[model samples]
Target: MNAPEFKKLPGVLAFQRGLVITDALFFNVLKDSQTPVMVVRHGIRGTQNVNKDGDAEKSTAANAKRQEVSNIQTTDTAKLEEEAQALAVRFGLRFLDLKDVLFACAPASTDANDLVRNYRDSVTGFIERAKTSPGLDEVAQRFARNIANGRWLWRNRTIARQVEVHVSVNGTPLASFDALATPLNHFDNITDAERQVAAYIADGLRGDDDAGLDIEARLDFGVRGALEVFPSQNYVEDKPRGFARPLYCLGSPERAGSRNGIEFESTRTMGHAALRDQKIGNALRTIDTWYPSYAEHGRPLPVEPNGASLEAQEFFRDRKTSAFEFARRLNTLDPASPEGMFMIASLIRGGVFSGGKE
Candidate 1:
């Protein structure tokens, strides 16, 4: 697997997954999955007046935006700033921070509170739209980054040999460690045949003799489903740079809100199918090594006393399990009773079910 020729190549191949449902305001352009539009919210919404310069005095536009941005009453500007950033990150959106543009868009009044609040509310509403909208809107941004960076990486590689990997995601892009990016519930409701195919996917990833097939891939998708054990939610980070979750989902749009990270590792890849297959191995092992270490930084497991219960077993299994094995165990858990089915469904929801149901 250590072929120096294939160590690193150039250029990223990204198969973009667009939003299933566009945001409320941008619905006109975003409704059709095939049709994508760069949603331009109130022009001032993204325009930012601040740069690294400290000496640029405000022109009428700058002064108006400054006045407007400053007028928004908030006890904690830091918190407000963080909110603005989080919204930006969650949606993988670019916040132009055009306080100046906003001023240009409207009349400059000494009282900017009402106008600022209106902008804030607009941003807040966009955040809400991101939480539930089917993915696609945000992944476009990721693809943009990948395309731009991959080209650069390709041009600057150490090897004369070049490689490229094309990937399409099926879930929301939350910061994730593994390829289990499909929503758990989608897997949960599937027929046994689906599980088997999924299991095959897992097996294809970690299978013996499956080595040397460089450029190969196994999708470790994220899941979306009801959380049975903790019945709780995630503690999100809100800032301009990073979010507690992944910024984009790769595959299907319906699975957007799961915010579960899943997609190709990078844009650069090799044309060699064998090389690509082997690369999938590398990606899988990397994910395997990091999932447990990174998944529970500050998060706590919800209290579930019965270790054998669906919630309890899954909590432990998912935490310590491999993507392939997790799928293998699906439906094997006695499917005779309702609890078994629920458990199986939960496993599917957990992105672990990959076996064909008999």
Candidate 2:
């Protein structure tokens, strides 16, 4: 029989995210009670901008006429209450089976469908090999390190004097980590607790169990004063004057117009300050040390198809290192290699990767 002819990828190909994360809810811990931290609107006075260019007399006059203006700012701020010692953030994580990674794949034509059918076994073999590979295990280890290090806390982690992370599998308590003591910049060294967590995560990825992991992280500022904590900020296209920043919050529909209610993304709410699931997932998957510039940059970026870093304003990967290129050569790559691991990790990260023709 003639070999199957395949020159291009399927027109519609996508993978479901393997590492599923839930939105993290924030709570203000006060003595024996835990309450949801609500977003509040603050009204403050600020001086207006004064033109200081051109004529000196005009500049002086403009400065003199500049008046104090009332500015209303709406944001979500979490703090340890006067009687509280810590702020708690709770979220859940689910690791999907890599064996069932593909979410969608629609071939453009009958020939293409035949080609994919012929190539399916090769792809399956690669995935099966990856399951037992050390490279994949390393990826899982990095993910666990992020959890143990409290990287998901984002800005809140910076202000925390002490952080404790509690993890559980299903409902059973597994391990706790001293998040403050764990380094965030590198994953070269991992404590025994981090390794334990990584084993569970690796098992989950390999489809050893279906039950997910639950996590709760507490940040202690070591002070009774209200120290501001950061929550995920919402993106508003048409922000009103003085309302440039908006924080994310969750509330019930029944509380929409109630006296204790506030806007979902704006206004003072009886809701809770929380981080988005996307943000949480991004933190968990910041394990792309395989990127070319990672050695020079000294930081791991989130696994992306292009090794893109929005903050750095650069794409670290060229065509050779891109996910598309890796996918193209998946059948030939050694599943235990770093490049192969990164390709599989990208699939776990999940996205539309249809390369229509050529």
Candidate 3:
């Protein structure tokens, strides 16, 4: 019998344990793919208290200090880890210990977004170190180039080398199929104007349609004229009835170059369909979660009618997926998603404060 194809995806999309991702957007991916959620957690790192750098044997006191610095309740951490492991086992996904992939080359930093920063740095570092391995050097080189050009700086890109497909029915795991996964840049070669157009659409923004044209003829002409070259790929064009494909279809690189990559197209397409089915409210909900400050305004930025304090509102907002997921999906094309507007507001605010105090 032929071995099952594994998914080598760019990244695993896990539900942040405490955050409430919109039911519409969150369930959309789940409803479509029907894949088991792969929970992730990082390992302990040493600070002044411990020497986790090398294989040096530290004193008992150091170990105690490291545990103390973890700031995590052992009972809670162990329970969470146990639950995640159990889920993997129940779903029949090989228990993948990703500590090596996460921290093998992480740099110590004091940034507020340290986990994300370290993850990016570690992935790049791992790619560099794994250059001698087959089929990795080229990927590393391309990734480095993309980063230098800020291709993924605004978006969430994934990197998965090992993946398994488990068939589930009614949310119950049934059968497991092995697969491989990897990173792909679907829109790296698109012109800037085209990207901008996709960005606008993905942000749930609409413009006056002209006859059969989606955006105004003048705006469309301006964008096309600036491009100098038109994309001939059928996938790049709008579908019949004048709607564009969801970002997932156009953003994934066509050439994953692996046997599993071939399977990815179908899976990705299904995911796109799921996302496309989501209502615009999903995106609005995410935006609302991210920028509660705008709540003072109405309609465009809805705040609860309750007379909640600013700090209370913020605390509640932070519990939503907007806190982390937006930063991950910031640059990706999701024509129906709201990250574009949120990111734009953030950028504009940053610029406004660049020359002065907030």
Candidate 4:
């Protein structure tokens, strides 16, 4: 397959396999692509602070300490601020503090943090009461669940496009990118799906025949399972952002980890079905190109000789070996034997069975 040309649509930003794309990263992409636009949606975390001159600052050490105590990962405020400012200048873009807009819609006295707390509590309360009042709580429950899980209830045939906003206190709002004065339309006023469609049309975008169908297909792929690898115990926490690895016995204690390879390029699109599926489709094709490259040069084999037993060691010898040989070797071991079971379990845990699992 040939590389897809990045569409040069002004004012409309395009993303490819961008699961971890933060606002800064998005700006960097825009800068790199040299795409010019009249406006952009800029989201920020409430914890960040900004000065009147629009210089972004990090939450104080006190703030970091607070987050640490709460078990939240600490962000490097200085680094983030500098990058944000530099990108804005380089791109000649303006910014709006989206978090402030969310709060502004609340009572004037409400604090930014308090606004988040209020929304959280309200949603939680609605869910608790949903069982007794499905009519009211059902929709609320769906909204809450979507936000909490960052997933669409597409199986339920529901499409709610609620936009969530967060801003850093030290974040400086750029004059060019600010959307506060224009005021974004509230999803509550109309179905989010409608809002998005209208925005697409307003941006001079026409509907593609398979856009929705393709999105559903990708979403289904993600829900079913999108990766061919499983991560080990040592890197359990390092599991790709959107995939989950369930524990199963493999080695003596069952060595836990993914096999197919260290990472699958497609894993990045997991959990973000709301994003354009066309971009993901392109990414999938791009990753598919790797197999031929690997086959030509000979796939690299792991050399770490450690395992629960000799059988497992052999199993890890060179996974690049033909599948027929791999299966035949497993069959030679007795199912009733502990070593046999260990080898079989190791293969299962290492994602040997995940080849066509998706």
For model 3, the stretches where C-alpha displacement exceeds 4 angstroms are 1-49, 52-187, 191-354
RMSD of each: 27.5, 5.3, 27.5, 29.0
Q: Candidates' lDDT values, in order? A: 0.22, 0.77, 0.24, 0.22
Candidate closest to the true structure, highest TM-score? 2
Per-residue lDDT value at 166 in model 1: 23
Point out where model 1 deviates above 4 Å.
1-33, 39-190, 208-358
Looking at candidate 1, the ten consecutive residues that score lowest on lDDT are: 74-83
Error of 1 at 55 (Å): 34
lDDT of 4 by residue, 1-358 (tens): 1112111111211111211111111111122342111111112233323233432245322233232222222111111111121111110111121111111122223233343334334323322332233232222222222222222211211221232222111243211211121122111243343333223212211111111110111011112111121111122554442222322111222223354576322111111012122222212111111121334433222211122122223333333333222322332334333333232222212222211111
| Candidates by lDDT, descending order | 2, 3, 4, 1
Clash totals for all candidate models: 75, 0, 22, 27
Window of ten residues with lowest summed lDDT in model 3 = 210-219
Model 1 error, position 27 (Å): 12
lDDT of candidate 1 over 219-246, digit per residue (tens): 1112212111100112344432311112
Model 4 bad stretches (over 4 Å): 1-26, 29-358
**Lowest lDDT block of 10, candidate 2:** 252-261
Model 3 compared with the native: what TM-score?
0.19
